[model samples]
Structures are given as structure tokens and as C-alpha cells.
Target: MEERVILGTERDFEAFAAAFSRRLHAGDVVALSGPLGSGKTAFVRAVVRCLHGADQSYSPTFTFWHRYEGTPAIDHIDLFRIDDPRESAELGLEEALDGSSIVLVEWWRNAPELVAERRYEIEIEGSGNGPRVVSVRRVT
Candidate 1:
């Protein structure tokens, strides 16, 4: 299923994430696509806060991957720094996607092959200080 939402405030986005998280489970992959400062990391943080009950997730743009402990683990990944898609092998992505945790990948376009077929794709469109148009789809 796919849904399009307009988020006028940061609180609205968090509310949407909280509702969306209820549909997620371990082994699920969420691909976040948006321009810089489009609230990709903020979305991840919201989802993590809802599921893991904490906001410890940071953009793994430098570290590539960060895992937060919870009932169903959260594997947050940022591939913006990857010059080669093959480098994802070193990030233990396979382990994260092995169905033990929920995986959120920002900049998944940098390494599309690393993403599983059955996954959720979220695209956020925004400019200036306007409201964001967020499109969420299940790409199974």
C-alpha cells in the first residue's frame, strides 16, 4: 500500500511516523529518498523513537551504519558517502537485512542493488520553508 501525506510541521511528520511504524516489523527495509535537509534523518529518528523508544539514531553518512537496541532492532544506514556500490559488502548490510531488524536506508540510490525487493520507499519533496509532500509506497 502507498500513501501521500502533507506534513506542515515537524510534529506532523513525527505523528505520521508513529502511525507508520505500526505497520513495520523486523526484516523490513525502508528506503528514504529526498534532497539534502529534506528531513530524511529526522524521519529515521522519529521512527526509531517510536519503535525503539529512544532517539539515538544519527545519520550514518560518515559511519555508514548505526544500530539501536530494541525489541526489533533498527539498522539505520546512509550511503551518501559511498563511491562504489560494492563497498556496501563491508558494511555488514547482509547481516542487518537478514530479518533480524528493521532497516532504514537513506541515499539508497547510491546502492540500489543492496536493497531488498520487498521494501518500503519514502520520498519527500520540499523547498524553502514550505510544507513537505511525502510519498510512501511499498515496493514489493
Candidate 2:
């Protein structure tokens, strides 16, 4: 089953993310997808803050990956620059899925293979001008 919510503002999105954090744990994978300016990074930032009590999350667009320290740690990855699954493997993504930390991936469509059975799939739909419809689903 999927849970859907409409976030009318940034605060609402953050609150949603904060609450969603409780459902996550080590070895889990989260896949986020949305268009530019659709609040994907913001949602992730909130989740990181809620989990670690500090805002250490950032968009891995240019860097490709960012690792955060927490109870179980977090590996944030952005596959926007990757051309294919082969390139994703070249980035050590396979090793990152060793079930030691939580992995949150952006632009997951570019590397669907990285998403495992026990994963959370989040999709945000909007242009940042109004309320965005966010859908959260367990992908197992």
C-alpha cells in the first residue's frame, strides 16, 4: 500500500519527512524522484535532521555521493550524472548496498538496479509554485 500526502508548503514537507524518518532503519533503501525544484533535497535534509539531530544532508548532484554519520549512517547518492547501470556499478554502488547503512538515492530511474526489494519509493509531483502531491510506497 502507498501513502499519499499533499504538502502545501515547505514546512509541511519537512514535517512529513520528519515523521517518515521513524519508519526507516539501517539497511533500508529510499528512492526519491521528482522534477527540478520539486523539494527532493529539502525532504532528504529533513529526514537527516530528524534521524541525527543535525542537518548534514545535501544534494549529491555534483559530488555523486555523500556519507553521513548517525546511528546507522546514511549514504546519499545521486545518479543524475550516471549514464547507465554499468556506470552506477563503477561508482561502487554495489558495495554501498552491503546492508550497513541507509541509502537514499535521487534520480533513481537512472539506476533502477540499485533499488532493492526492501525499499521506500517516494515521488513528488509539482512545480514548486503550489502544493505538491507526495506519494510514499514500500517497494517490496
Best lDDT among the predictions, by candidate number: 1
Candidate 2 residue-wise lDDT, 66-113, digit = tens: 777677887888788888777877787665688898888999889898
RMSD in Å for candidate 2, one decimal?
2.3
**TM-score per candidate, chains pooled:** 0.90, 0.91
> Cα miss at 67, model 1 (Å)?
0.1
Considering only N, C-alpha and C atoms within 3 Å, which residue pairs clash in candidate 2? none
- Give the clashing residue pairs of candidate 1, or none: none
Reference-based lDDT, residue 50, model 2: 89
Residue range 36-139, candidate 1, lDDT tens digits: 98888888888898887764654343477888877788888889898798887777677677899999999999989999999999999885567888999999
User: Each candidate: what lDDT?
Assistant: 0.86, 0.84
**How well does model 1 score by local distance difference test?**
0.86
Alpha-carbon runs more than 4 Å astray in model 2: 55-62
Whole-model lDDT for model 2 versus the true structure? 0.84
